[model samples]
Target: MNSNIDLKELWAKQETGIPDTKDLVKRVASFKRAHLKQVIYANILLLLVAVFIVLVWYYFQPEYITTKSGIVLIILAILAYLFSYNQSIPLLLKSSYEMSSADYLQQLLSLKRKQQFLEGIMTNLYFILLSTGLFLYMIEYTMRMKLPLGIFCYGITAGWIAFNWFYIKPKTIRKQREKIDGLINKFHLLTEQLTEKK
Candidate 1:
């Protein structure tokens, strides 16, 4: 109704301190870098654990073939987890800081979906593999031990595994999803702000 208003002139005079799209993208890039570093550290730790397991198997050389197979399974699971994790980090790091708001939002959403999949399906698979591998490896050793000792060992092992699968994993997944969802919402809001008329 205000035909006399010069919209373009008003827009040109708009405040400069509003959230800059490039700055948002830079923030996202920094987040990705931090996440990548965590991933690298976690993968390295996993590799070290795998190496330790292999060393134990090599030096001990349990008489049962099942024990050897269990060790192999554990190694395979670790390698699989590493490969899956490495695939995502490079993709995440590829998001350009100069990307437009809409493009960056799309990237963020895609990354969120990928993260959910990783946290849900891949995580479950990894834990399952670990639990099974450990069970198989422990079977021969447990059988040779006295009944009370075997019960105590298996009880502690089962308790720890249960705690991880039921509590730690779900809590971790929830936190991860919350973080990514928060980022996604932030990007959406930023995009809206960028697109809004002054």
Candidate 2:
């Protein structure tokens, strides 16, 4: 009886360190808002780029079929990427502050899976299409240039693409994964705490 009382007192004295549900909900809502904003910004930028490319194609009107094909491939890559990227928007929109912890966790997991797919397969496809398109697109312009200039152009473009593929893309993916993983871990902890309390 004395040990039981001591245990109860110790338990009572211990700090829960658990965050308030309201605050957790607010943080989650903020995350959702930030994510949605990022999506919107990315979509707008990609669309603008696509429009710019189309405008250039219209105004320049290169004689070579390779140039036309390159332009089409680039546009197709952008559109395909946009379509695949937007697939996550609906999942994001489905999440809400009012959701139970378990539900929210499930939603986040789903979003993470979607992100993985985007980062892996879709990204690979986009880069492949873009690289091929760029090479094809440069053919016509480079042919008109002096040999040294044409070689320089190809070298610079290849270097840029390689940098993006090898460095920038991996860095971006790591950052994104860390952010989502942190959020998921927080929610997992919150769910466990809530469950224990019940």
Candidate 3:
């Protein structure tokens, strides 16, 4: 029964060739499984570090850090870590798309622009986040007014730099967004082709 379904024949036709119903279902399921495996492997070390954090907090926190401040510090650390890592989920998922379509080498080559476009969006999002963080940090610092004038000025300057990086980082945002937009169009084409094949 499996021998009857030819993936190449289905993929090539652009009409009625991209495998039978069952095969397509199986292929999508396989793709999802592969994606999950990649996510797990990609974060294996991160998972270990998280495990280590819990173990350390449980076993070796010193007397100085035993108070509420220590627990607050731990929570902040985990939140910061999660926020940064979550940003890369798409890129992580995308590694598969890199090697997923082996036979479609030319098509694969064509996906560079899409990849670049996605990256730009992601980068822009990162900058926006950073700028926001800096703005809040500045607010907190100014509210306290406890630091020396030099340190206060430095914090504001860093915030300005972060704002620039978010919106005006030379070359990166423009290039990445444009490239990914182009790729999105190509992906639309691919989806259309797949639909036609079906």
Candidates' C-alpha lDDT = 0.82, 0.82, 0.56
User: Which is superior by TM-score, 2 or 3?
Assistant: 2
Q: Find the candidate with the highest lDDT and give its number.
A: 2
**TM-score of every prediction relative to native:** 0.71, 0.67, 0.34
- The ten-residue window of minimal lDDT in model 2 covers 88-97
Error of 2 at 96 (Å): 6.3
- For model 2, give the RMSD to the true fold: 6.2
Candidates 1 and 2 compared: the better one by TM-score is 1
lDDT of 1 at 179: 83
Off by over 4 Å in 2: 1-41, 96-100, 187-198
Best by TM-score: 1
Candidate 2 per-residue lDDT, tens place, 91-149, comes to 56666768876777767767766766665676778877898898899999999999999
Tell me which of candidates 1 and 3 scores higher on lDDT: 1
**For candidate 1, which ten residues in a row score worst on lDDT?**
1-10
